[model samples]
Target chain A: MPAKQTLTFPYSRRPALGRRRFLQGSAAVVAGLAAANCRQNLAGPPAGSGGSDGTLHIYTWANYTDDSLAAAFTELTGIPVVVDIFDSNEVMLTRLQAGGGDAYSIIYPSDYMVSEMIDLDLLTELDQSRITGLDNLKAQWQNPAYDPNNAHSVPFCWGTTGLLFNREATPGAPADWDFLWENQDELSRRITMLDDMRETLGATLKSLGYSYNSSDPEEIQAAYNRLLELRPHIAAFKTTGFENELLGGDLSVSMAYSSDAIALTLEDDRMEYIIPASGASLWTDTLAIPATAPNVDAAYQWINFMLDPEIASAAVERLFFATANQAAFDQLPADIQNNEDLYPSEAVLANSEGIVAVDTASTDLFDQLWTKVTSA
Target chain B: MTPAPSPPRPWADRFATRRWLGPVVLLGPAGVWLLLLLVLPTLLILEISLVPGLRLGQPSGGYGLGNYLQILQPVYLRVIGRSLAFAVGSTVLCLLMGFPVAYWLALMSPQRWRNLLLVGFILPLWTSSLLRAYAWAAILRPSGVLNTMLTTLGLPAQNWLNTPTAVFIGLTYSFLPYMVLILYASLEKLDTRLLEAAADLGATPSQGFWQVTVPQTLPGIAAGCLLVFISTLGDFVVPTLLGGASSMNISRLIYNQFLGPTRAWGFGSALSMVLILAVSLAIALLLRYGDKSSVSET
Candidate 1:
């Protein structure tokens, strides 16, 4: 499951072996990239990112699609699927807008990003007529707030943002966000959190009984202050690389996405993931075709292929993300169906709020306060 | 001065076009590469920097100093100060540590083994720099090898990972080879006659080294320091990987603007231009005061 850690390291292999030759090659590549970036279309996404040749290019989070899934899709559609990964929704958005995602026929954007892309006209209105098994999606996602009636996105997988803690190393099992603030002395320099701006700050915001998508300047500033207090105790704010530390007892706890956290918990019985009492951010990763996507036919086929209950169940079992398809959920093994980390109860999820596309001013404030939080 | 005509020959006839052609052929590809990659991109950044508050996916605003002036804010100034401190602190550490090894390698080590010994010193360079930083993380983390060794030796464990100290260690480790290589080059050509002469003039060993060896290696020192300074100033990996929440240097700050939650390209470009200017200034100083001899002394 480490293969699906969101921020997987890039393949840094160089043709040259010696450091000197590698440095020279890297410098050239950097310069060549700078030269290439000079010519950009900043207004909107390109007309067609290399309209589909025979292959379906999937721009998605790491671990979302494995060889089995791609091979299965290829076998069914007779068109091959190639997968590329991005750690952040914003990064995926930037890649699409920067004209670099031309070859991609599908992208897996998270809940808020789905609507943001729709607003930017970067997403194609998904053809419901061609897609199958839409009715199998859970009632909550049948008409999700981010994309009403699944106009431009299909809810593929969903999860919560919470703490993955080592029960023995930690002072006590943390049940909520306030545990860190309360045990600052005991946990000093022994805790880590997601490096994500929204998730980190949103968690802080939720700890204060405010909205995760707080638009008020004062609330955001308060969250910054609260985070600053905990800053000294945090070993690092990392998205993916804290696993080793947590396992080694260096980091007692880390705020992680449920997908990654569940894998770690399953790896070791001592490790446990818990959603804060206040609530956690609920995120749903959706499959959508870009407005500039080529090979619309292949894209639809890929979506329908994922929608199949058997395939979704297999993917959920293998990749470890909670499936949004009710049919797929029923197909999971009884133990997996009841794994709290994978799928917390409705009562636990009652307070969870899906991060939505906030207004521009609020977004700016979030970015500004986030910059202050990090740089300070 | 231009009127002397030699006997006509095919080689001489070709010289007419060859005069400009030689320079064009020699420098053309390099010039185009620089113009397209370095100069053009820099100019593009400069243009973007002049605009105020340009958001990604949004239209650029009219020309203003909003972005550059924003750097003067206390928050950003602190970031710049930290970056400068890291670069300067790492440069000093590299020189203090590298000089002694370089001196021994160049002047004291046996001639047959000097090259092999230097190669051994720089063997860490064979690995990718990202790998090197990660190795340091493994060694320096609280529950890492260093802590285990310390506890075993009845010493207090040090938690250095994800701190400014960790950043210093990472940067120094990354650039020490280059520093030693450059200093070794300059120190290799030390005029022993001058040192011998200093000794004859009733000077002690320290006095002789200060007066003779120091003066001779000053250019090398300047070159090494500036090279390390420029590289560390803009380095993104070490500080981000090892430097924790508080380690927001200029490179990371600029990265945040362009790629982080906020797509403030105007501000990112502005920050970028400032960094480029700083690096370019360091390079100008390097060319002006650095060793005129070869940098690839290895």
Candidate 2:
């Protein structure tokens, strides 16, 4: 019967290969050029070479920027803010290290990245006297582990890595990271984990009652094995593209960032976001001035503008990001302020840990394990 | 043609002295472009690939073959194998689907509408390939168009979107137009008289097609197949978007090493060199064998 099914669709056997041969032939050349182009861009000069005197270039996440934000900043200050977005911190760091990030005065790097950058001496130590609203940050962010005393970076927004699921499709509400492992059969080929190595592998480590930043080889190997067992059930290692599938009921669950999850939950009530009961990785994105910043004065102004309570509160409402500013949180509507997913209870918070940069040797171990997991 | 040698031109004769100028001027821009952008960059990648465990912005530990040796691992080998399988699979699939459409358009279709039909076949290529891959995601998902159509026809719905099958479908769909275009070009110049001659010799239509048509368009078939094979091998978008969990081909692997958390430029470069070598080999085969086949056919 299976053989009959295979024969019924020619594609089932391995579809005919010659039809689009020529198109792909040229596209292959383009892909090669693109790869080369990526390498060049990585190795190129820093971003501010365009020779715009009035423009303040900012490299940040895609979700952090909007036309209104840029326009309002430009309106308040005469300098126009040019925004460039990066999908991951590693990519941004690599570009910067390669010499392609010099054009931007302002950059948004996550907590661990800020620390890494500071250690590398790539960030400017801010003179707090020049900047206002440093005290307005939430108590936790007042002196973050990544950047104590707000020396190098200012907190932009914070969130947790967790599971987002459609209540109707999932067998039950996934309370913890173990839910995925326990219900592997039910969620088969219908779940997506984050593409980030630290987040996904860290989640597995946490499920086994180890630290999110575990460095022990045995613990790492155990986490890798646990993930390998659940590998067959995962549809893909995706971060952004799973939204449509999750909403359409095609996906039972997806591992997501709190910001992305909260945005989706707002759209559809059935989509529920949860910080796994055992624990999750807490993350904070921060705005920092790179050492090679061209317009330092304008960069300071941009930071001050973001630090303002009215602007920060308005941005959170419009963009669906949790604000790092305590003053900003106070100004938000009652319902948004009370949302537990965005601002989880203290006990839940205590359970979570921020993902810091692991030592070089451990990073290698993680990379090796990740390659094995994906390839397998 | 061996005329008496002309007297050596004097340096004073500007025109004769500068005889090499025209060719130099004409080819210089493109030659320089290929040298700088293509040749130089490839050489740099070769250099980087030799550095063992070279991460961008990190101190390099001199040159070694460690990066290339790393590729010998079974895990990495599997990625290369999967990439080859996709390339070869898609090549054969494209050839099978493209030949018939090319045949109709080239020979049987109305002569007046031939160009229009060819244009229509290539219409999908105008849109971004990334957009096209996303469209396939929409059409192949569980609640998507394919399943809806299948259920309507009382056929079983397929769960293919995040599987190897979807990768094949996306790849074949993406590359089919190029196959048809190339095949049509080959088949259009085919001699109809040979088919008639085979028939006159009491050969049946199928036999005639096998003996005459197939042999005549052998170069086109080879060219089309090689083109598809080479392209599909390095394809990143189709496999990443549609191949789901099992879609870790060499291109994506290379991407991960370079831009992903690993930042292992040495390994990435080594992988890239392998991809470049594979593409160059395919092109060489097309140039050598494809030309020979056409020459023999004529």
What is every candidate's C-alpha DockQ against the true complex, given to 2 decimals? 0.29, 0.28
The share of true interface contacts that also appear in candidate 2 amounts to 0.47
On TM-score, the leading prediction is: 2
lDDT by residue (A1-376, candidate 2, tens digit) is 0121221212222222222322333343344335434666554334555235768888887667778899999998878877866667887787787776567788999999998899888899998888899889999899999888989999989999999999978999999999999999989998999888899999999999999899999999999999999999999997666776776677989999998888778877788999998889999999999887778888899899999999999998877788899999999999999999898888887789999988988988998898778876
Error of 2 at A108 (Å): 0.7
Candidate 2 lDDT over B1-298, as tens digits, reads 7999988777757786477788788899999989998999899999999998786656888999999998999988999999999999988999999999999999999999988988999999999897788778878887777776787689998889888899999999999988887788788889999999989999999998899999888888888888889999998888888988877899888887877777788898999999999999998999876634432332
Candidate 1 reaches a DockQ of 0.29
Q: What TM-score does the predicted chain A of each candidate obtain versus native chain A?
A: 0.87, 0.89
* TM-score of the second chain in candidate 2: 0.92
Q: What is the lDDT of residue A239 in candidate 2?
A: 61
Q: Can you tell me which runs of candidate 2 are displaced by over 4 Å? A: A1-37, A43-47, B1-16, B291-298
lDDT of 1 by residue, A166-211 (tens): 8878887998999999999999888898878889999999999999
Model 2: residue B35 alpha-carbon error in angstroms: 1.1
